[model samples]
Structure formats: structure tokens, C-alpha cells
Target chain A: MKGWIYQLKSVRKDKFCIMSFFLPVLVAILLNFAGSIDLSSLGELQFVLTAGDLTSETTEWLARYGTVMICQTEEELISEINDPSTNLIGIEKDGKGIKTILSGDEWAILQQAAGTLPLLYEQRESSAQVGVQILSRPDILAGYQHIFAAMTLVVAMFMGCTFNAMNIISEKEEGVVFINEILPMSPKEYLIQKIGIGFVFGCLSALITAAICFRLPFARAAVMLALLVLSAFVSSLIGLFIGRFSNGLMIGVVYIKLVMIVFMAVPMISYLAGVENRILTFLSYLIPSSATLEGIMDLANGGTAMAGKDTVILAVHGIVWFLLYLLLAGRGKKQA
Target chain B: MWNHNKGNRDPARTNHRLTGKSCKTRSIWKSLRSLLQKDFRMMRSGKFFAVALGSLLLYTLFIHFAYVRFMDMEIYQVYLYDPAGTQRNVSPLVHPVASLEEMDRILHKDANSVGIHVTDGKPEVSLYTASKKLDRHRSDYALSLLHPGGKYTPETVGGNNLEQKNRRDITCELLFIEIVAVGFLGIASVLFKEKQMGVMRVHAILPLPKSLFLFSKIFLFLATDLVFAILLVLCNVGLSGTGKILPGLLIQTTILSLVMALTVFGCAMILKDFRQFSLAYLVIALFVTAPVFLSANTSIKMTWIRFHPFYHIYMGLKHAFFGIPVANPLYYLCAAGAVVLLFGIVKTAFCREMEKEG
Candidate 1:
């Protein structure tokens, strides 16, 4: 335990791993905050709908009044009326007869102050069209949050793995391996220290991300940390394997990077299409990013339930991959 | 005097010698052959051959056993609710549920059915709000039931039957899936192999153009993808259907294939390793692929989909499947331009990877 602490302290001194762990979390938080910026100006909607006609027709009309985004369907009327935006909002039709979808306090507000321009909305019905329609803010936000979280996880995995995988190989290049071999500490302890430090860094970064960017609940925070730990460990082992196999540190890192891209990244097609393929569904359960996404999505959407199965699967990934890495690295080290 | 000099000089020999060429044409051919052979061997070893063959079998099995079975379930159920018996022209297949309440119950029960609620006047089509784009469809469906006398036979734009429709949709989806997922990885794997073998750096010292290295990889992936696409279409869509639209489909495939391959190649070279690549991949899959897929396939509509590049690609694939060619030439122009732009970035990244310290 004491040795582990010392190892952790030494590993923290390595700036690359530390930076990789935190950079993605910071970027993700900043980007999410950027997206949260309220940029909906009243002038824009007026220009879009009125097209200079409103300005020309009613000079006294409050052009700066609030706008309502109306859907063409009749059902949209009910939804729009209930919307907070509809309070004190005006309406226009695509072709003719602009029935004010807004009523009550909003209607009174519109009637009292500004002259309303009721434009026609032309409804042309067709039979052969298919489209996607998101129902609410929660749904949209949930999707965006999942995507953002997954991206953050991916960036973190890449950065963490790249450095850790190259750690030993770079030491070998500088003949530090021989120096380390002369020390009282075993090589295994050194490798464990490195992996342990990487994992710790990954955990801290993830917690920070969840707290700052996601604003996750305790359950979600726990889930995210679990996923990050798994990812860190698995990635670190992969790095170890790469370090052992290649002639140079960069080559090993690059090679492992290529493998990760091909085997793990590409097969993850579900994220791209917004629909999970059956084959990929099975694989998603295996990947840390998948867990991160599912967990973070739950967090963002205010879900309280812990994903027990996912946690176990992630733990399994960490363990199995770690063992596989040790075996491969051990073989490569022996051969070298 | 020129003729005499040409005859004495042996024009072919002189031309060859001046070009610093020793059986240059032959060597070029030989080199190309060796390159192809080496690539073929490398590809086979990379497990792509097994993966491709396995994927083909798996997809085929799913299509036949699962997908086809599921698709055969039922067409959209039609409900007729004419209180005054105004819907006499209603087809026998139409469920004649009495009263508006009954019709509403049936629509709610099935949800997939298009209900013709002719309570008072002209028939009003009632279904849960699908989307603004699908509004026209719901209305047209209602109108069609009213005017049963007008045999409005759709004009056959291309020779595509129902089976062909299925084939095209499945083919486009499969191809899209393959390109978006598999081909992207395939390009990365090849680059990684070259990167690992230290041959990427070797290209820098070679007399052959650096662009050729990137071009060669892109060209090969494009050709492989095109061939896979053609086969997938032919096998599933039927020979007759594939024959009619193969040209257009191929055009779409080439564009998607090249674009995806270049994107993946650029990603692989620019990112540090597969871990980083995976992160980038996850981001791409989430932001790019997820949005495009959802916007294109499901009823879940993103108002911002119009701005998404992949959404256009997914739609383009769907359009290709339906045999309705994207009539706008500008779409193709844009697609081509995107491919070129992606290619340029990939090339730059590839060069950078080669130059990076070992």
C-alpha cells in the first residue's frame, strides 16, 4: 500500500497522463456550456415568417414581440398553446387565415400592446413522406448529453491509453528499464504503479466531468466513475501490451491506437445512426464508452437507477482486458 | 533532315532513355502488381476477409429469417368511420368501425392505422401527430379513401417493384452501415499496419508521390467497397432490379465509400492511437452518425437535421434505394466537393504521421 502511494506520487509527476485525463472533461464541459447559451432573439423569427411584409404593413406593430414556433399539423396547435413560449406570442399561417393559437394571458398581452399580423398558413397534404420528430426538450437533451458524454469518454480513453501504452517502451528507449531492473522494486510493481496512477487520474477526471459538465446525481456519478475506471484500466493494459510489443514507444502506441480504432471504434456503428444494430448491441455491452453513454444519459435525464448489469460488464471488460494485456506484455517482454 | 535523324536515333529508345527509364512501363506495371498483391495478402491477414464473408452470411441469414419475416407482418391498417355511410367506396380490407369514438379507439389500439374520421363533411384523416413532413401523407391517405373512383396510378419512374423496394432499402442500410462502421475501420487498420511496419515513413523517401500513398489506399478501399455494394445489391435486390439501377446505386456507393474511407483515414493519421481514435469515433458516432440515422430512419425528427451532412448522406442512400434519383445536380456537386476536401485533409494527416518521430 505504501509502495503503491509512492508509485502514485511518481506517476502524477508525468504531465502527459495528467493532461490527457482532464483535457477531455474540461472541453466537454465548456462545449456543453456553450450549447446552453440562450441565443433565441425575437427579431430572427419575425424576419423569417413576416419576410418584410409585417414591417411594411404595420408600422405601429411591435415587431420585437415574442414568436412561437408552430408546426403545420393540427395536433401541433394544442402542443403550442400549452408551450411557455406561446405566452404573449403571435401566430402566422403558411398560406391563409392566421388563427391565433395563443390565448388567455398571452392573447391579452398580444391584444393589449402590439398590433398582431395574422398571416395565412397554407396546408398542402401529401401521402408519401417519412420523417423524424423529437417530442420534447428532455428527449433532445438526453440524446445530446449521451453523445457529448460518449465523445468525452472516447477522447479520454485515447489520451490515457496512448501515454500509458508508451510509458515502458519509452523507458526502454532510454535504457531506464536496465536501471529499474537494478532497483529493489520488481518490474511488476513499477507497471502496477503506472496502471494504478493512470486509473486514479481517469477517476478524478471523470468525477470532475460529471460534477462540472453533467451535474449528475449520486447514482449517475457512481456509474460514470465505474465506467471511467474500467476504461482507464483496460486502456492502460492495452498500452502495456503495445509497450512490450513494438521496437519503439511511438510505434507501439500508434499500433495499439490503430487496433482500438478498427476493432472497437468502427464496430460502434449504433452511435452514428441513432439506432443500435443487433450485432453492435451485443458489443456495446462490452465497451466502456457504451457504459459511459448509457450512464451519463441516465445522469443527464435525472435517472436514479444504477445499471447493475452494465457495471458488471464493465468490470468484466476491465478484468479480462487487463489479464489479456499482462499475458501479451509478458510474452513480448520475455521474447525481447 | 528530322526524319533522317529520328530514324538514326531510334525514337522509342531515345524517349525511354531521356525519361531515365529502364523498361519503365513494364516496371510500373510490375510495381503496381506487386503493390496489389502485397495489399491483398495484408488485407487477408488483417481478418477483414473473414469479417466480410461472415458479415455477408450473417446479414443474408437475418434478411431471410428475421427481417423478411418481420417486414411481412402487415401493411398500415386502414380504418373507415363514415357515420352517414358516405364511405361506400371504402375497400373491403378497410375496418368499418362504427362511430368516431370506435375509430379513435381502433386508432389508439393499433396506432399504425390511418383513421378516416368522416364525422360531418369531407373525411378528415386522424392519426397521432407524426411530423410536419408526414402531414401531407396522412392527408393524402384520407383523401384517397374519399375519391376511390379516381384510379390515380402512380407513374413508374424506375422499374422498381415491392421486392426491389425492400432490396434497395436493406441494401442502402447495409451499405451505409458497412461504410460508416466497417470501411472506416478498414482504412484505419491498413494505415496502422503501414504505420506499424514503418513503411509509412519509407514512402517519404521514395520517388513516388506522397499523395499516391494516400490515393492508393483510398482507391483500393473505394474499389473494394463498390464491389461489395454491387454484390449486396445484386444478391438481395435481385438481378433484374440491380441491373436497372446499378449505375445510379454505384454512383451513390462510390461517393459514400470514398467519403467515409477518407474521413476514417484522416482520423487514424491525425489521432495519436486507436484509443484516441476510438474517442473521436465515439464522438463521430454520437454526433454525426446518431443524428443522421435518427433523422433519416425513425419518426423522431430533429429540426436541425437539414444542416447535418450525414443526414443528407443517409437520405441520399434512401433515395438511391427507392430509385428516385436525387434530381438536383448540386447535391452530387457538394458530395464530390466534400470527398475532395476530406481527401486533402487525410493526405496532410498521412504525411504528418509519416514525418512523426519513431
Candidate 2:
């Protein structure tokens, strides 16, 4: 109880720690604003450069694709095409035929657009009588807003791990470890208090983030909250393990970065890139944070089937890491 | 006071004053050298270089083994279900599906793919709904593949092939992240260690100027980052044509390294402990760097990203990687001015920290 009270006092006094607790809320608001900006038009946007005068008919036809820029000489057109920063498809007319210039780094879709324009112009009509039908998949993940929001929430929850590690290192630096050795409390109890505080803060921060960013029904919200708690427990144990071994801030940070890259970045990137590699998928599921991310994303997309597996993985990780931390703590006590 | 008569004419007194000035200069140089050595030893003990080397190896392996291979995939896959076999000139890239059920299963698995169902010599395109514009592009791409021979082939202009472009692009981004994130935290960790050890306070009573302490660290990290940039280019970008880009790349790395190192130096000096600095680091890394990446790399446009300083720096580095020098004189001026301003702030903070009671 004293330990918890002391931690509460420390966190209350530390303005930065308090700010960190609210950072997710702040980031969620920012993401909300960003989400309003429409990026759909980017797919259709293109820059077309032409040398000399184009027939009015040609200009009108080119305008169907995107913006058309006319340059006085072939030199100007080539210059624009040479600028790797801009993706411009250049057209130059010669006596024999027309030449099309490309920067080579254009997207495959844009390249297809470039190729189809001239052909479609020559045909003067759509060659393939294609009727386009849009199939709606209700099970697909939500827009970038929710994905980014969930990512931010997950990253914010892991802040508990960082804070816990820093807390232990700071205590060691301030000679609190030696002072605690002579106190009545056992090291196991002390370590548990630290990890417990971290777990509690992680849940609180995650709740704030989820509440501000997402509006879900009670059951989904409750499931998400439960998953985040499990994630927090596993992360706190990892933090406890890291803090027990690492002597300095740099090493502690290095360990945290490696953990985050594996547990957070891999799953997020795979999800974003739509990677279907089985080995990568298996590896992602094995990591507790990655599993939690998958669960959170599933819940955000209105699916609950995957949460069961994620909960099992996180619970297993929590137990294994906690036991390892206890073993390390016991050895340290014996050495002292 | 009458002893001034001997001092005015005595060579010994004059020599003593001269020697005193020279001794002070020598001691300052000696102190700076020792400080540099100590920092180097501390970094070595902290395994910073080992970590950096490990990162370099990992990045190299990833670029070669994974990233390049993964990028070879097409933007969108096209599947065709043509029972009538009416499309004689279909692109070889399109996959032929046996039945409508097969197409549905594939579409469910690969949501981004477009399916063309041809019935009675007419093509019908179906896809999972993305954006309206992207959907149009995907459908257009799918239809264009039907008459592959009619597609116009363009003359190639200047630019690296897709493989080289991906390599350099990823290398630049990783290097930027390494400097901005890891290097920033590294300097803070070293400084915080010194602060905890009461070494900064000890420097106050020493005869050397406090600024050397900051300079040694800043220069050490700058040199380390520059070397890392060089090796990263050589390893990932390969030996071919690295010489041309090294100068501009190193210059950009120097500017970024100095700015990050000095900013963190100032923050670490002012902040009371590692926990506060960690929070500060998080804020800077997330809020400051995230937008620069999103605006530069993605289609997400921010009207105000031009005002962001790191945007220009990041673009400059990217251009350097692509063999385009930043011709804007204003950029260099601003970077230099920022560096100078940060140096002043850090110096003041270091002095204030030195004056604090332990």
C-alpha cells in the first residue's frame, strides 16, 4: 500500500509523466482532423508535359486523364521529365511519329494510365466494352483513421513499458535499490508493485485513447479494454525483466526498441502492406503486443473471433515473462 | 604597492605572466582531449557502437533479403474469368480463373485485386470497393490489360530502375530515422549518465570552459553519424556511384546530426531525469517527425508542411540520394542559422545545469 501510494505521489508530481498519460488523447484529436482530408483524388491525379503546341482536340483528350502542361521546346519537356521529384509523362511530336517520355519511377497504375491514354485516343473510343461493378466487403478493415488511431493507441499502451523501465533505472541511479534492501519489503513485492503500477497506467491510458478515438458498442469496447489489459500485463512484465537486467538508460532503451520493432512495427507493417506470408503471420501471432494489435484491429472492424486467440497468447506471455522476472529478482536478492 | 618597481623592469615577472596565459590555453586543450576520451570510453562501455553496428547489419540484410524482394510485386493483381475465351490479346500478367466461385474466393482473400468476368464477348469488372478514383484506376488497368498490344510503350527518361530507387529510398529513410530517434536518445543517455554521476558539477570547478564538454559530445556523435551514413550507402547502395552522392549526403547528415544532438543536449541538461527526457523524446519523435514522413512519402497532403523545418531537411536528403543537389540557398542558410541558435541555447543550459545544487 505504501509502495502504491509512493508511486501515485511520484506520478502526480512528475508533469511529464502526467502529460504522457494524456498524449494519446491529444494524438487522437490530431488524427481526427487528419482523417477528414480526402486522399481519394490522388489516384486520378497526374502531371502530363508536352513539347510544342498540341491540337485543341489532343489537349482536350489529355485533360481527361489529368493536368496538361505545355512547354515551348523539347528541352523544357525533357527537363521536367528529368526532375525525379515530379512524375511527369512527356510527349514530343516528330515528323515520323510521336515519342512518349517517362521518369521510370512512376507507379504501375500511372504507367498503365499513361499507356492507355494515347491508345484510347487513337481508337477514339473505349476499346473494351467493360461494365464495372463494385463489390462491397463489409468485413474489410475501416479507413486509415481507425487503423492509425488503433496504432497510436497500441503505441501509447506500450509507453507503460518505457515508463516502468525508466522508473527502475532511476531508482537504481538514486540509490533507492540499496536503501530498499534494508527495508521490510521483499524485492518480489517491490517489483510486483512497480509492474502493477505500470499495468494500471497502461490500462488507464488505453481507455482514454479508445474512448476519445472510437465510438463502439459496449461489448466491443469491453473486449478491447480486456485485451488492452492483458497486453499491458505482458508489457509490464517485459519491462520488469528489462529493468532488472539493464544497468543504464541506453541499454534499457535499446531493449525496448528491439521489442517494439518486433512486437509493434512488424505486425503494423504487415497489416498495412497486406503481406500474406505465412511465416511472418505466425511470428506476429507469437508476440503478445502484435497479437493484441491484431485483436484491436479485428474489434475495430467489428469482428470478435480473433480476440480469443490473442487473449490466450497474451496471457501465456504474461505468465512466462512474470516467472522469468521473479527468477531474476530472486537471484539478485540472493547475490545481495 | 612599491613592489611594482621590480615588476616593471624584471624579465622574470614578464615571463611568468606570459607563461600563465599559455598554461591556461594548454590546460583547456588538455581538458577537452580528456573529456573526449572519457565520452568515447563511456559510449564504448554502453555498447552504443555495437548496437549501431548491429542495426547496420540488420538494415543491410533486410534491404537485400526482404525489402527489395517484396517490392517486386505489382500494385494490383488482375484476375479474369473468361469461359467464352473471347479475350485473345489479354496481358500475360492477368491470371485466368476457372469459375466465378474461384474469383470470389480470390477476391475475398486479396481484396485489392480486380476480377474481370467476360460473358458473350463483353468484359465486366468487379472489385472490392476502395475509393471511387482508385476503383476507376483499377478497373481501367484491368480493361487495358485486355487489349495489351494496343498499349503505348514510352521512351525511358532519366531515373534509377525500380530496384535501385527502392534501395536508396529505404536507406535514406532508415538513416534519417536512426539519426533522429536513436542518435537523439543516445546523447541524452550519455549526458544523463554524467549528470547522475555528478560529473557536470565537477566540471564547474575545473578550469576549462564548460562549452568544451558540449563540443566534444556533439563532434563525436556527428562524426559517428557521418561514418554510419557512408557505410550505409556503400553497403546498401553498393559500390557503384556512391562517390557522387557521398558529399551531399554527408553534408545533410552533418546538419541533421548537429541539430538533433544539440537539441537533445539542451533538453537533457534542463530536464531533471531520464523519465522526463524520455517523454520529451517521445513527443519530438512522434509529433515532429511523423508528419514529415506522411506528407513526403504518402499521398496525404498537408498545406502547412512547407513550414515544417524537418520537411526541407528530409527532402534535401532524399534529393541528394537521387543525385539532385538542393539549389535553394535559403535552405542552407536556415539550417546554419538553426544550428547556431541551438548551440547558444545548449550552452546556456549547460551553464545553468552546472550552477544547480546537487
Candidate 3:
């Protein structure tokens, strides 16, 4: 307890501590704001298209959705001319039918529009009303925020591990480890202190991220804070385990990069959690980020933040890591 | 001992024979050879090479066995609620719920799913709308399922099948991410090591162009990235598809590799410690990732993506994977210019750090 003040003071002046806490939250806000706008609802897209001897009927067909400008060559696309990097939309009049230089969502939309073309050709005489009603009303922002929050949490945890590991390495390099070893503090006490600081940091970051990014109620926010604390503990275990065995400064970080990808990325894809592949679905439980994200989603959707399956899996992850880190730290002390 | 060491050097004789300076190319190669050896030793000590090899193997295996099959998933789940069995002809893809409550529960759980509510013997669309376009699509999908033989035709856009398209798109994205994120970490890790060992102080006194130090690390990372690309493309896109795209892929990969490597190198030198460096990841990751992924892939398009530098680079790589490499000279020029600019910044920071330590 007495040594914690010094630890707090050191953390206060660290540049990484300040920046790491703020940057990801800023990104979270940015992503939430960007994800706010509905591009699909935006009225009319000006399409610059080119075709060989384009029919007036085709041009008229596209104008219902947006004003279509036709150029003789692909280079003459109005949009493409303004921006050198713009995708050129071209239509080729083929023997079979018509083909457009577009794919994916654009291709599908064009097809749907083309389907309406014949309808328009037939309904040229009647004034028909067309409209759409969104029935289900899914919270789009919540999902985006959840996914973005999950990604930000991954980055934050990775940062936590790297910073925690480097702190120990720096102490060892400065001969402070020897001094600390001789103090009345037990190895467990020392480990607890480090993990405790990490837990606090983890909690604060989650608070800041949630407060800025997601509009969670107090109860849900506290649950999220608890989950982040545990996640940060798991992250600290990664740092200490790697730090204890590392020959020098960067080795632990090198290993953490791989760990980050494995622990962080696999979970973010979400659907991979449902894959029939047992190993992949199984890995989601073993890695803390996977369960953590699920917990966040639960809280976002008004369910219990940490449910049975994820709670058990993450607890196991945390416990196993804690014990392994203790073993590694003990072995490292004995070797030294 | 000092007198004996002085006699061994015999600088007067050496200076006379060498005219005090060797030619450019030979000296450059000789210096590079030694610098590369030292950098390789540093990488070996840090296990960067072994870790990279292990990562390559892991990513390749995941792609071939797991990711390829896993990624070919249902686009979006469509839920159906027909109180009177009005949707008796529901497509196999649609999940039929017994009640409206059940449908609402599933939609809340899976926000991406589209739901169909049947009232008065006619289908009404229900979905958590992601975008106006996506909402319209989901509505269309439900309508299409209810009536498959509609006048609206959905023609397949690209030459590739749905599976191939998924493979190519995701493969391109993962490869870009691996290089940018992992490559950034790799360079900074090596730089962090040298900073830890105070190797920069020694280099400060060495008689060579300082750029070689930066060059050695970049070259090593570049080689590693190229190998990673080959293995990734082969494992995911297959060998035949790889041959067609390798040239454009390599060019774009090199551009992104250098851009990210130099950026991190600059950051590692400027930062005082590894912890400080790690804290910057959120900023770096957000800058490189958010705009790139959101604008390129998602329905929520930020108009400013056109101005974001990573947007162009990401699209270029994606195009290369699909056999349409970026042809604009301006794009290449911007990429080259960015690398050179970042290199210059890293060099300035490196020299300052060396001086500070000295």
C-alpha cells in the first residue's frame, strides 16, 4: 500500500499512459459518428458511365434512381475526371445483353434497378406509388459501437500487456528488481500490485471508452468495467510471462504481436464464433477478447453482461494465466 | 596496451593506400553487407525471423484449412414470423419463428438479420437497418424469397463465384492488415531492442551514411513482407491465381510495407521507451484502419475517405487481388513520396536520439 503512491506517481508522468488512454477512445467516438450516417438513404448518386452507342432508353432507365451522364470513353466519366482515383463505371453493349464495370453491392443494386427498368417501361402509362417500410428496427449504432468497441478493447489490452511487460524489464535493467526482492513484500504481493494497477487502468479505459462510445446504463457500465478489469489482468499475465523469459527489451513485444492477433482478431470477426469448425469456436472461449466482446454485446442489448459460458471461460483464462505468470516469475527469480 | 593497439592500426599507411575514400558502389555494398549482418543478428536475438516464420505458417494453415471454408458463410440471416402459416413457402434460408416475440428476440440477438412480418396475408419487411441501401436490399431479399420469379434480375457481377469473391476480398484485407499492423510492430520491436542495448550510441560514431541503418531494417522487413505475401496469396488465392496478381501485389505491398515500417521507425526513435511506443498503437491503428475498412467495405461511407491516404492504398491492393492493378501514376507517385517523406522524418528523429544518448 505504501509503495503504490510511487507507482501512481510514475504512471502519472508516463507519456504512453496518457496517450494510450485517450487515442482509442477518440477513435471509438469517430467510428460511432461515422457509423451514424445512413449512406443508403442518401438521395441520388450521380453515376458517370460510358458505353458504345448507349441507347437513350438505358440512359432514361438509370435516371429514375439518379442523374446518369454518358461519356464516349471510360476516361471521360465526369466523376473519374474530377478525382484521379475514382472507380470508372462503364456499360458494355454485348451480344448477350448488357454488362457493367461494377461488382459486389454496386452490382446487386444495379441488378435491382435493372429489374425496375422493365417495370418502368411497362408502367410508363400509370402513376404508381412506391415506398418501403423498415419493420424490425435493429439498433445499427449499437452493433457498430459493439464491434468498434471490441476492436478498441483489443488494442487497449495489447497496449496494456506491452506497457506492463516493459515496466518490469525496465526495472530489471535498472537493478530495482533486486532492491524490491529484498523488501518485505512477497512475490505474490508484488505481482498483485502490478496487476492491480493494470486493473485500475483497464477499468478507467473501459469507463472512458463506454462513456464516450456506448450509452450504457450505470449497472451495465459497471459490469463492463469489471470485465475489462479481468481482461486487463489476462493481458498483464501475457506481459509478465513474456517479460520473465525475454532475453531483452523487444523480445516480449515481438511475441505479444502474435498473441495480440490470436487473442484479439479471431474474436472480432463474430460470425466465426458460429462456424461448424469446433477448434475455431472453441478458441473463442479460450481467448479473453472473444468472451469479452460477447459480454459487451450482452450489456448493449440489455442482457446480463457476463453470462454463464463466457464468464466461466474468461475466469478460467484469467486464473490459468495468473498461475502461469506466478510460476514464471518464481523461476526467473530463482535463475537470477 | 594502448601503444600496442596504436601500432596495429597504422592509420598513416592505410590512409595512403586507400586515398582516404573508396569508390561509391563498393563502399556502399561493403557497409550494407556489415550493416545487414548486424541487423540480422539483432533480429535473430529478438526472434523476429523465427516469429515471422511461425506466423507465416500459422496464417497459411488457417487460410487453407479454416478461413477459406469458414468465410463462405451465409450473408445475413433472414427471420420469418407468419402467425397463420402465411409464409408456408419460406425459403430454407429463412428461419421461421412461431411467434412475433420469438422473431424480436432473434433480431435483437443478431442485429444483422432481416425479418419478415406477415399481416393481412401480405409480407412486411423488418430489419435493423444498417444503411438505406442495405435496408432496401434486405427488403428486396425477403420480397424475392416470397416471390423468386420477380421481374427484377440480380445478375452476378464479377467473374469469380461467391466463394472465390469472399476468399479474394478477405485474403486481400487480411494481408494488408498483417503487413501494416504486424510489420509496424516488427520494425519498432527491433528499434526498441537497439534503444535498450544502447546500440544507437555506437552507430552515432560509426563512419557511414546513417540511412544504411534505416535501410537495413526496412530491407529485412520488406523481404519478410514479400515472403508473407507469396505464402498468403498462394494459400488463400491458390498458385494459379497468385501468378497473375504477384507483380501488382508486390508493388502495392512494398509501398504499404515501407510506409508503415518507416512510420513506426520514426515513432520508436522519437518515443523514450517501449511502453510509450505501445501506447501509440491506438492512434496508429485507428489512422490506418478505421477509414480504410469503413469506407471500402461498409455501407457507411465517409466522403472524406477519398482524402484519406490509406483508402487509396487499400483499394489498390484489393484491385490487384482481383486482377485490376491500379494504373494511375499519381497513386504510385503519392506512395513513393510518402515513403521518402517518412524516411526523412525517421532519419531526423534517429539522429536526434543518437545525439541525446551521446
lDDT of 2 by residue, A1-336 (tens): 988998899888988777877787788877776446545544444555554456676666555555567777777787677654566778655343345678787666556566655554454357334678899765233454567778878877887887788788778867897888898998778877898778888888888888877788988887888888988888777777677777867878888888877876776876777657898788767677778878888787878888777778888888888887778778877896
Once superposed on the true structure, which residue ranges of model 3 sit more than 4 Å away at CA? A28-137, A140-142, A150-160, A172-175, A217-222, A225-239, A245-247, A271-283, A305-336, B1-25, B73-158, B351-358
Best by DockQ: 2
Sorted on DockQ, highest at the top, how do the candidates line up?
A: 2, 3, 1
lDDT of 2 by residue, B93-200 (tens): 899999999999999888989999999888899999866556666777677778776546777877677778789888998999889987777777878888888888
lDDT of each: 0.58, 0.79, 0.69
Which candidate comes out best when scored by lDDT?
A: 2
Compose the digit string of candidate 1's lDDT tens values, residues A1-336: 776776667567755455557777766776567544222231122212223323333322223323324345544544433322222333434343332433332222233222222311111223223231222223222344355556566556655566666666667866987887667875567678767665666666656665666666576677667666676666666666676677753346447646565434542454543444677677666656565456555555676463555566768877887777667657756895
The TM-score, computed over Cα atoms with residue i paired to residue i, of candidate 3 is: 0.77
Q: Model 1: residues >4 Å from true position, as ranges?
A: A1-31, A34-191, A216-336, B1-23, B54-171, B200-215, B234-240, B260-287, B298-313, B334-358
Name the candidate, 1 or 2, with the larger DockQ value: 2
lDDT of 3 by residue, B100-203 (tens): 88987887777767777788776776677666545554555555555433344533344565456667777888888787776677677778878887889889
DockQ of each: 0.05, 0.47, 0.27
Error of 1 at A7 (Å): 8.3
Per-residue lDDT of model 3, residues A1-336, tens digit only: 877887888888886776665666776677577556544433233445676555776666445444466677755553342332232234445443454444332323343444443434344333122234565454465354466666676566555676677778778778887888888987888987776665667556656776776677777776776677777778877777766766556566666666776776667665334455777678667777888777777777677735445666777898998887778778877997
Over B15-68, each residue of candidate 1 has an lDDT whose tens digit, in order, gives 879676757766665766666676677777665565666657766776667554
- Predicted structure 3: clash tally: 4
